[model samples]
Target: MPNPSDYIALGSQSEEETEPELEEDSEETEEEQQEEGFIPVMESPRVLAEKESKNGEATVCSNAGESGENSQGNEWNRGDIDGLFCPICMEAWTTTGDHHVCCLPCGHIFGFSCIRKWLQQQGTTKKCPQCNRKCTLKDVRKLFASRVVAIDGESQKRIQSLEAKCISLDKKNAALIKKEAEWKKKEAEWKKREALLQRELHQLKEKTIYLEHLLDVKPRTLGHPPSMGGYCVPSLGSEFNGQGPFILQKELGVDGARLFDIDASSKIILMTRRLQGLGGMHVLTKMSLVAPYTRQDISLPTGSKAVRDLHICPSDGSLSLFASLGKKLSVLSTKINNFILAYDLPAPAWSCSWDLNGSHQIYAGLQNGSLVVFDMRQTARPLEFVNGLTSNPVHTIYSLHNSTLPSGVTAVLSASSAGICQWNFGGSEERQPVVLETGNQGACISLAYCPSSDDIIASFRPRIDNSNEMAYSQHLLTPAIGQGVQGSHVHLKRFGSNCYQKLAVTCANVNDVRLPRSAVMNIESHGCLFASGDELTGELVLQELPSFTVIQHLKLRKQPIYDIKYVHDVDGGLLGCLCDDILQLYGNHALK
Candidate 1:
C-alpha cells in the first residue's frame, strides 16, 4: 500500500502538496460539495511544526475521515474511489497486511493475497483484476509504504532490520533453482544405466540356456552296414549298373551340377558347367530328360568362366548359372532362339535360387558377404543388394516360401563362415539381418529348407585342429580304410529366430581325402526324404529330414562322388549321382 503522503501528491496532481492548495480543490468540486460539504484534507503546516517540537512519540492524525484514505480532499476511500476492490475476492483493500496493494505492469492495483491465490489456482495463466489482461507473478510489483508516522528511534531501527531480511530470502531462492537442475540431470543418467543392465541380463540368460542344451549327450551314431527295414528309403535299382559313360565324353568335366524337374511338362533338366584353360572358359550343358533313366546333353553359350552354381525354374524352364571367372550371372531359356542374358556381379557368386512366388526374381549370394537380387525381366541391373553375416563369404542360400510370415516381407536365409543369417527385405536399404546361433558349433557349411514343415535345416562342421594331426591321419588311414568310425561328424541344426536347436550329429560315410564340403545334401520334394552323397565310399546316405536318422546306406558309385539329387516323378523317387565325371540314375525297383 502506498503511504498516505504519496496518495496526497497523486490527488493534488503535483510532486509536493500544501494544505491551502488541497482546500481550494475541494471547494471547486460542486458535486462532491453537495454530497458531504467536506472531503479528506492534508495536514496543516502548523500541525507538522507542533509535532516536531514534541518528543518523537507525537502521532500525526487527520480529522476529516476514519475510512482508509489519504488526506488529499480527493476520492481515495472505498465510498469515493472507483474500481478499488479485488474482483477475485469481491473485497476492498481495507486491511494493511492481508489486503496489501499489488501493482501490475498494466498500471492496475489489487489486493496481493487475492491475486496470488487466483494465479495459483489457475496455474497456467493469470489476468489483472481490473483490466483482465494476461499477466504473471514476475510482472507484479508489491507496493510498500515509503514513509510512515514519525516514531521513537528504537521503533525506526526495527523497520530497517526487516527490510534487510527480505533481500537475503531472494538469494536463497536462486540457489534452490540451480540445485534442482543438477539433481534432475543425475536422475536421467541413472535411468539409462538401469536400462542397459536389463538388456545385458537378458542376453546372459539366453546364453545359459544354450549352454545347457549343448551339454546334453551327443546322439548315438549308427555305423557299419546300416539296415533299411521300416523306413520308406529309395535305393539303386537294376536300371543303373553304376557303369555309365563319363559326362561330356570325359573331355571336359563338371565343376558344378544341379537337377531340376520341369513340373509343367513332367520333364527334368540336368545343368552342368566346366571351365577351359588359359582363355578362361565357360561351358554350360543343359541335358533333356527324354526317358525314365536317359538324358541327352545340349550345349549353350559359354560365357567367361565355369559355373559355380546352377538352378532352373520349376514354373518356367529358365536355366540360371553363376560363373567364377568374371563373377557373371547368365540366364538362358529352353528356347534356342532366345538370347542368353548376362549380368555382372560385384563378387564371385557361389549359390543362386529363384523366388518361390514366381515373381521373376532371382537371388544369388556372393563371396563378399553380399546377396544381390535380380529381376529377370530387367536383366541389365540388380534389383537390390543386401548384406550377410559379417564379412564372411556366403556359401549357401535358401528362399523361405512360407505363407506364415507377413506380406511385403520377403525372407531369405544364407549360410557363411560367420553363421546363418536371415534377411527380411522391405523398403529400407540399411536393413539388419537376424543371426541364427546353435550352441558352439563350427562354421555353417550348408543350408536347406523343408517345405512340408516350413523349417530350415543347417549343417555345421565341428571345430577341430587338423593342422598338426595331418601326418598321423595319413598313416592311420591304411588300417582304418574301411572302418566307418571316422572322428569327423556333421552337426545338424534347426534354425529359428536368433537361435537353433541341435537335431543330430552323425558321421558321414567318407574317407580321409573327403571333407564335409565335398559331399552334397538335398531334401526330397515332399521334405520327408533327405539324401547325401559320400564321395569317399561312393555311397548314397539316405536319411529322414530334420531327425536325420539313416534310412539306407546304398553303395552306388565306385569312385569319388561329386553331387547328389532327389527327383519325384511317376516313380516314387529317383536318385541322381554325379561322380568321377559320370552321371548315374537310380530308383526304387518297385517302380520298374
Candidate 2:
C-alpha cells in the first residue's frame, strides 16, 4: 500500500498522478493502532471507473474504517482534517462537496462560502475571515482541496479565464484613478481664481468709499454771490481812508439785531430784539456759497427777553441762543425741528460761547458775577458753577481753551466790572481762580483769546468814567482816573507776559474795541484782525493784530455799531455789521 502523503505533496504532482506502492509494509501494535484511530476503506469498482471516465478526474475520500486516528498520538476528532472544515462556522466543509476552499492574498485560507459571507458583512472593507486582512473578491483565489482534482486541460482553461478578467479590471481601475486626479486639480484652480476675484472686489469697494469721502470734503466752487434778502448794495470802501480787500455786498433790515453768527457753510443766524414787542426773534439764514447766493430764512419762535448771545456748534450745526429777558436759554435744534429751553436761573446769562477745544461744552457769564459751564451732552444742569466773585455783572466770557494748555486743565477767561480773571472749570470748588493782569480796565466789556496762539484781545472802560466817556456819549472826554484806556481800548497780551500792548494805537476815537465772536477766530483763520467802532465818528475800523495796521474802515449812518463779525469761510473774510435796525454784509460778493 502507498502513503497518500507521498502522492499529495503540496503542488508537487497532478491530481490524476499516483505514487507506486512499496512491496513491504511495517506491522503496527494493536494498542498503538487503536490509539491512532487509523481508518481504511475499499471502494466499489463502479465508482472508481466512473470517476476515471471524466478525463482522469479523481476524488480522494477518507476511509471510514481508518478514521478517528491521530498520527501524533492525540485523540482524533472530526475537526482534525486540514482544509476540510470551515474556520468561520466550525463545520465540515465537504459534507456534500458543495463549498470550495478559498485563499486570501494574505495567505490565509477559509471556506469559500464562509469568507464570502464575512466579506459581504464587512461591506467595502472585504477583510479576510481568518487573518482579518483587507481583500476584495478580486483579490481572493479559489483554492482546491488536495483530495479533489481536475484534469490538466480543464485546469489550464480556468487559469486563462482568471488572467483575462484581472487584465480588464486593471484597465478600468487605472482610468478611474486618473479621472479623480484631474478633478482635484481643476477644483484647486477654481478656488484660486475665486480668491483673486474676492480680493479685487474688496479693493474696488475701498476705492469707492474713499472717493465718496473726497466728494463730501472737497470745496465746491462759489460761482456767484448768495441769493440775499436784498439785492447787491455796493460797499462804501473809501469812506474812512480804507483800501483793503473787504467790501459790503448786501444790507438787510433786522431790527434790534444784537447777536449774529456765520458758520463754516455760510449759514447765518441773527438774534435780534423786537423793537415794539416783548419777545425777541432768531432769523436763521442759510447762505449757500455756490450760488446765486442762496438765502432761506427760518425764523425760530421768539422769547420774552432779548437774545444776547448766539453760538453755533462746530461739531454739529446746532444753534444755542441765550436770552437776557430771564434765566431762559433756548437751543434751536434743526435735527429735532424744535427748541429746548433751560430756565430758572439765579441771574441773567449775559454772554455765552462754545468750548474752543471742540467739545460739546458751553460756557456762560451771568449777570450775578458768576461763571457757569454746561455740557450739552447732559442738559439736566450745568456741570460746574463758580460764584463769590465781585457782585459786578459778568459782562464777557472767553473760553481760553487750546491744545497748548496743560492736560486736564479746562480754564476760561472771564471779565466783569471788578477785573479779568481765569476760572478753572476742571478744578475743585475751593480753588480760587487766578486773576491774570487785572487792574483799571474797568468791567472788561469784550474779551477774545486765541486758542492756537498767545494773543488775547480785550476791551474795557474805566470804573470811574465820567458820564461823557460812556459808550454812546457824544460829548468830549475828560482824562479820568484809570491806568488803562479812558473810554475803551484793545489790549493784545501774550499768555506768559505781564505787560499788555495796546493795539498799536492805530485808530483814534476808538470807543468800544471788539473782536469777532465766532469760535473760528484763530490767528490763521481770521488773520489776527480786531475791530473797533469810534463813538464820536461812527466809524468801524478793521485792524490786523501784532502790527495793528488798519485794513479797512466804513463810516456808517451816524449810528453806533454794536458788533461786527467776520464770516469764516473759504472765500476769504466777509464782515457783518449790526447798526441800529440794519444787518449789513460786507465783502460778501467780491471775495469769492
Candidate 3:
C-alpha cells in the first residue's frame, strides 16, 4: 500500500517517545544481569543545537599524534562538563572522529576535533568561552577516531526522512498484528459452527442409512473437491516420499572449505547444522524470541546497498553483520532492523567476525590493524582497541577459541592486505604493533583462524618470487567445488591448509557456472549440507559441502528460490527451499 517509508516515520516517533523510558529500564535490567553475567554494545548519537557562546579547538598531530609507548595517557582527564562547549550551540558537547577527552578549566569532555572544526568556521578563537575562564587545556586525550564533519541541511533532512519511515513501518506491523488476532477469533467462531453442522450431518446419515436398509434402497455418496490432494497413478500398494526442508550456508569464506566433507580426514562432528533459505546477499537478525535480548529491525539505508559479511555469535546466538557503504563502517544488528548505528572507521573495513570476550564484550577486527571492542553495556564508545597489525587493510577478522581463553587472554587474529597479526585485548594503541609479513602483500583475499593451532589459513595472490607464481594464480582462480558429482549431486572440496604444501586446485572461471542471484539460503543443522536453486533453469539443487557433492536435484514447477533452509520438524530435519511464493519440502528418506 501506502509506501513503506510513511510507516517508518511512525516507527521513529515511537522509538523517540519510549527512548528515555527504555533507557531507564535498560539501566535496571543491566544491573540485574550483572549479577548473572552479560555484556552490552554499539554507538551513534543525536544531533542538537545550543544557544550561541564561544568556540574552542583541540588538534593532536605531528609530534603529538605520533604512535609510541603510552605517554601521559589520561593525564588530560578533567572533571565534569565545562569549557569544551561550543559558543554556537552553547552546548558543552560536540562529537568528532576522535573521541576527545579534552581538559577544560570548566571541566568538560566533547569532541576535541568537533570543537576545533567549529572554531575554524567562526574565524576567531576565544579562551574558556563557556566558563569565561582563561583558556588553558593542557593535555588532549585522543583514544578514539577523528572525523571531519560534512553535514548541512540536506543530510539532516535525509536523516529525518529515514527516521520517519522506520516509525511508520513499526505502526504498520502493530496494526497487522491486531488484524491477525481479530481474524483468528473469527476463524475460531466459524470452526465451532462447522463442528455443529458436521454432527447434525452425521446424525442425518445414520438415520438415512437405517431408512435405506428398511426400504431396500442405496444412500447417496459425498465427494471431496478434487485433485489438490494427489491421487498418484503408481504401482498399486506402493508408497511415495516427498522432499523435506533444510538449512544451507554458502561457505566458510575463502579461508577454508564449506562444512560438508571435512577434507575427507578422520571426520569430526562438532555441533553443526546447515542454515537454509538465505538467498539474498544481506544476512540480518530481525526479531528476538528470547527476552532481555533486545529485538531490533534490520534495514539497509535506501538504495543499492548490500552488507559485506555475516557472523553469528555462537555464545548468545546473536547475529552481527557489517556493511561497506562509504569510508565509514555501519554496524548492523540482526536483532535490530530499521535502526542502524554508524561507527567512524580508521580505514575501510575489509572483513569482520564476532567473538564473545569474557561473556560481555564482542571483539570485532577492522582493516586498521586493530581489534575494535564494543562493550554491550555502554553504547558510548568502544571499550578497547587491541593494536599491532600490518600497514595494509585488515582483510579478515575471526576468533580462535569458542570459549573464554585461559590466563584471561583471548587469541584473536587479523589478516591485512599486507600480512597477518595476532593480539590479546589488554594492550595499548600507543605501542609498535607486532607485525608479521606473510611473505608477500598481494591483498589477502580471505583468512580463517584454525582452532587447533594458532595457525591462520589465508588465501592470497601468490608472490612474484615463486618460480610459477602464474600457476599459483591459476589455482586460486579455479572453482573449488561444483554440482555434477552423482546424478544430481553437488561436489565440494574438503577443508585445505594454506601451505599449498597441503592442498591445491585451480580452474579457469568460477563465475561462468554461477547461478542466477538468490535472496536467501539455509543449510540443515544435521551434519553438513547446501541448498541450491536455479531460477533460470527451474531447478533446485541440494549439495553437500566440503566435498562439492550433490545429494539431490529436483525439477519443480520452475520457481525462483528466494530462500532455502533446513527446518527441524516433527518427522526430522527437512530440506525447505522457497521459490516465488510457495515452499516445497524434500524429506530425507530416513525421515519418511
Best by the TM-score measure: 2
The residue-by-residue lDDT of candidate 3 on 1-592, one tens digit each, is 1111111111011222322211111223323433653122123222112111113122322122122114434332222112323333433332333333343433333445554444334332323323333332222233222322223455589999999999999999999999999999999999989955754463354345434432331111123211111222223113223322322211111111111101011111111111122333222323221222221223344431334333444443333345342333444433333334555555444445555444455555554455676655677777776553444445456555634433444555666545555555543333333344444324343453334333333444333343331222222112332322111211212123111122222111111121221111223343344444542345665433344344445544324333343433344544444443233344444343
Model 2 over residues 166-271: C-alpha lDDT tens digits? 9999999999999999999999999988855754463344345434533432332133223222222234344322234454454554544555666656354444
List candidate 3 stretches off by more than 4 Å.
1-306, 317-319, 327-342, 357-359, 368-370, 386-389, 402-404, 417-421, 427-443, 448-592
Angstrom error of the Cα, residue 303, model 3: value is 12
Candidate 2 stretches greater than 4 Å from native: 1-242, 275-304, 321-323, 335-337, 341-343, 427-430, 438-443, 452-454, 465-486, 496-527, 588-592
**Best-fitting candidate, measured by lDDT?**
2
Q: Write down the TM-score of every candidate.
A: 0.48, 0.49, 0.32
Model 1: per-residue Cα lDDT over 1-592, one tens digit each: 2222322111111223212211111122333323543222344566456545654223112222333344454455543333344545655542235565556765566677787667556544455544556666555565543222233344558877777777777778878888989889988999888855653453344345433432321121122112221122344322123211111111112333332223224455455534223142334444444522233334444443545556566456655444343577667665662336777888866677777766577788886788988888986688888766466666667677636545565777787755777786655445678776555555455555654445555554443464322222221101223323233234344434234455556555444332222222333332354556553555666665556665566554235554555444564445566655445554443333
State each model's C-alpha RMSD to the native: 26.2, 23.1, 36.8
State the lDDT at 439 in candidate 3.
Answer: 43
Instruction: Give the Cα lDDT of each candidate.
Output: 0.50, 0.53, 0.37
Ranking 1 against 3 by TM-score, winner: 1
Clashes (backbone N, CA, C under 3 Å), per candidate, total: 1, 13, 104
